[model samples]
Target chain A: MTDNEQRMARAGDYVLGLMSEEERDRAEHDMERDAAFRDAVLTAAQHFHKLDLTTAPEPVPDQLWQKVSERIASLPQMQAAETAPASPSKPRVAANARPKRFGLHSLGGRGGFAIAASLAAACAIGYFGALATVTNPQPVVVVVLDTPANTPGAIFEAFADDSVRIVPLEEFTVPAGQTMQVWTLYDKAVGPVSLGTIGAKATEVRLQGPHLPLPKPEQLYEITLEPSPGSPTGKPTGPILVKGFARQPARS
Target chain B: MDATSDDDLCTALLVRVARGDRASLGELFAREAGRLIAVARRILRRSDLAEEAVQDAFVAVWQRASTYDGARGSARAWLTTIVRNRALNMLRDGARLDYVDDDMLEHFGERSADAEAAYAALPDREALKQCLGQLDASRRRSILLAYVVGFTHGEIAADLKAPVGTVKAWIRRGMIALQECLS
Candidate 1:
């Protein structure tokens, strides 16, 4: 078969759910890189999707929505514009921007407060080391922050005492009069609080953050570009260079 | 509402969902969950498993809503793709299926029937229906069983009483021809 025909056939296999797990993964990866392949897959998916719509709607269990709501109550939506890559070389981010608010308020629920309290108990055990009493030695949560381009930008290890060890994964070129400011949203009510600010040159620096509730899983951490020292306003004012949700390290 | 308007509403709701609007997500769920469950049930066969698939798909939708591009496809199609993939993954996990048993054989028969029923039910106006109808019966059945019910090549071979290699080729050629016709 011709290359275009082969691509179309593979796209058909992917849309039909016929590919093996490994093949599916590769096709998805290819879709990210190849616009033609992605278009083919999308077209095929749209074409076959009519079959899915034809199925008669079943009676959903009354509690199903409740269950879904509870599960997503603490989850935050990734902002399309904020996650958009600054450069044109990266994959295009969605152009639509409806809700423009930033920080914890964007999360739209108080359920995260309950999760934070529970996470503190887990943090007390200190999975990384036996010495739990060693004055904030272990990180409560490790966040691998990624650029809007989805490349690793930085790694943040937040401690119980709120001191975060920042490791820059990429050499972010902070403009002549600009600095990279770190921020986190621990609660919707409090909004995003500034963690610290780094200079023009990126480096590994530990910042002592304000004493707050213990860091929890899925907490938002981000770095934004602001004028000289920092944002004239306390909140992140400029474009987000990188951002990610905190995840707890696996228990050893 | 007609399908196009419903699709437009879904797209609008999804845009709101991408912005962290939980209420819109709920609205989308209330609107689409029943239909999604039905679609998933075809592949999963069990009501509870189908519900699980829909649940997972919603959570994924919440997380990845920002990635949804309208230029790529309709919101309904995107949602369908997510649920279908989830259900397919659950089936491929193989933990739920008891192999080679009489019960499984019965399920296989039911699955094949469901696949054909889906194709037979397709609207005559749909180009997909015309293209799929034109394929050889074995090829068409093989593609349908795989797409509609998440059947693997080996399962299709078993269902059609044909060799797995021949079934795979039939599907590959069938898909090429189908795409060519549809295009």
Candidate 2:
């Protein structure tokens, strides 16, 4: 099929819920980047929505509304438009921004490579300064995972307390039935253990991982796409989206 | 009120909801919740789960109303999409379904019936009805099963007694043709 035909077909699959979890993720990611595909999906979705309207209204329980109101009572609306008046297309811009590539010229594969150039350039400016002032214990080691395409995907700060803070540089789309699983190869014999899983929208967040020996230098850190809940095999089975080697943060 | 004006009112109320107005959300809920619950019920086939889906959707609508761009679609469509997505997710989560001892064949039969019932209910005047009518029966059934009832390719294959690959092709080609006719 022609490219446009294929795109329209995929859009239909998306609208019809026929795509697999991974295919849905790719389609959603494409929707952000491809205007035509987005338009196609939206149009198809709207058209098929006529069927939704035909559904006879069911009796909504009085408590349902009350429950919804209570649930959202503490939640705040994300005021994206009002907050960023000058940057009307801020989300679009962020979506389009390529993952930052750090200068890895001198750093060879799986080496400590001192926390000098890339760390300072990529992370130190914001996270280091902010984290230093916070009451949270200092991270034992930091890792900058690179996408297979060699662009920095996320930053991981492993702490002494078995908590890891993840700062994703790129917006990885995790559709409903899938999750992003974080893993570390602390021991080759033990294999890669899951730190935890995160939902679709990735942001700077801390995850309390399983108790293991203090994370050391050059430990493998990676994130993979897995079935919801986690990898069934309890090992890294899915395709790794990003991977990196750990580096001990220089003591202040 | 007519559908267009009802949709317009929803858009206006959603704009207020985006500005942190709780009353507007309540209004939208009063207006759309019943219909949304019914829509979710078609996919979930359980009133309690349907209610849960609509409740979650309302919370999401409250939290993410600011992101709603009316230029993309109608407020009603947006609301329906959110509820449908939530219901589909709940349906896909195997733990919730727990098909262990239940008659899997009977469940599939009922879901397929729900899917067809939805398509048959579409208004005769709707372009969607016309476009869907143009597709072959297999194509049309596959598309309906997927959209109206959240059937995966595998489920549709099982329902139609066709190979998975064949069901996938039917849906892809069917959707392409449906869009062409709609456009």
Candidate 3:
């Protein structure tokens, strides 16, 4: 065979699955880099698929269709599936088991000033200068807490200063005499650590300085409904109201 | 053979699927599922693997329906390519054909007159049949074995009782000839 014939034959082999795994990988890489080779491969694939025209159509088992439908229905978000290609999407591990909805809202006007003053005072008295300047130097990791159903609930911003700021995006009602407590879990395998308590009517709570040495990504930030003082066990004793993972801003 | 109404119908269903219409996906499955499973069965040579391939292909169809370009190829051809690739991946994963009886493989190769009629009825495929028929018997069967059953050159050589190099030459020449005839 001529050189052109040999090249086309290799392309044909790739389309027909005659190449070994390594050969196939090299050929696929070539197809991606070389337009001519890609065209040849697509052409070969189009031509070879004609063979199926003559093959008799077989019956699909009834149960197989059910399995496929059930699987598609179970996807967490069908919105992503609409535009996704044939190849699987990037697999991601949520710090928690659920997907989160994030909405960033700034604290503004008079309420913002009072809260900032109280936060600065809280930082000066409780944390000392060691933790105060920590956030000023490093990146702040923010966590947006949402329900499993993808409703926006709250936001947790972790500063390098070892302080975590929690803002409730949605209203929460604690039972009579009960308080809402915030917690953080760097690892799901380990249990949560209490950050501080917040009033039922409070719109935001900035934990002055928690025991976290540094704010890390994928740390779970959650709010649980607890007794007035807090969980006696030093762990979350009530049901979790909202939760999410800390994330760094996507780099440009 | 060029852009028939059936092709248009498949493309329409795919567009609906891209818009998140579950009913359209069901319609596409209803129309094409049997043939897709049959193609998968030929390559995988086992019912269980073929079923898995078909399920995966439909899931892909759901995920990739938006990527379908009608100007590029027929919708059936596009969907068939996805099924074939899925089945071939299973075959390449060291899924042997040993579980299937010999007659099953022969059944895949067998074509009744009605099947030939059905092939001729498909848009553009009749041209394919005419081109394929023009090849030598050995060349035609070698190409068919590779395309339909996902056979390697060595497997085709073993099946045809010919040397591997000779089988390779036939398929190469056969493909070149088909490309010329179809064009």
Query: What do the candidate models score in CA lDDT, each in turn?
Result: 0.74, 0.74, 0.64
> Distance from true position, residue A108, model 3, in Å?
36
lDDT of 3 at B160: 78
Docking class of 2: incorrect
Q: Which regions in candidate 1 have their CA more than 4 angstroms from the true location?
A: A76-252, B99-102
List, in the given order, the native-contact fraction of each candidate: 0.45, 0.53, 0.32
Worst 10 residues of 1 chain B by lDDT: B95-104
Off by over 4 Å in 3: A1-3, A79-252, B1-3, B95-125
DockQ of each: 0.25, 0.20, 0.16
lDDT accuracy of residue A252 in candidate 1 = 20
Write model 1 residue lDDT over A23-103, tens digit each, in one string. 765665565457788777767777888889779999999999888887776554334544657533211112221222223
Q: Chain A TM-score per candidate?
A: 0.47, 0.46, 0.44
lDDT of 3 by residue, A185-236 (tens): 8766667877777767657656644434355668788888888877788789
Task: Report the CA-based lDDT of candidate 1 relative to the real structure.
Answer: 0.74
Question: Candidate 2 regions off by >4 Å?
Answer: A76-252, B99-104
Q: Rank the candidates by TM-score, best first.
A: 1, 2, 3
DockQ of candidate 2 relative to the true structure: 0.20
Clashing residue pairs, backbone N/CA/C < 3 A, model 3 = A135-A161
Best-fitting candidate, measured by lDDT?
1
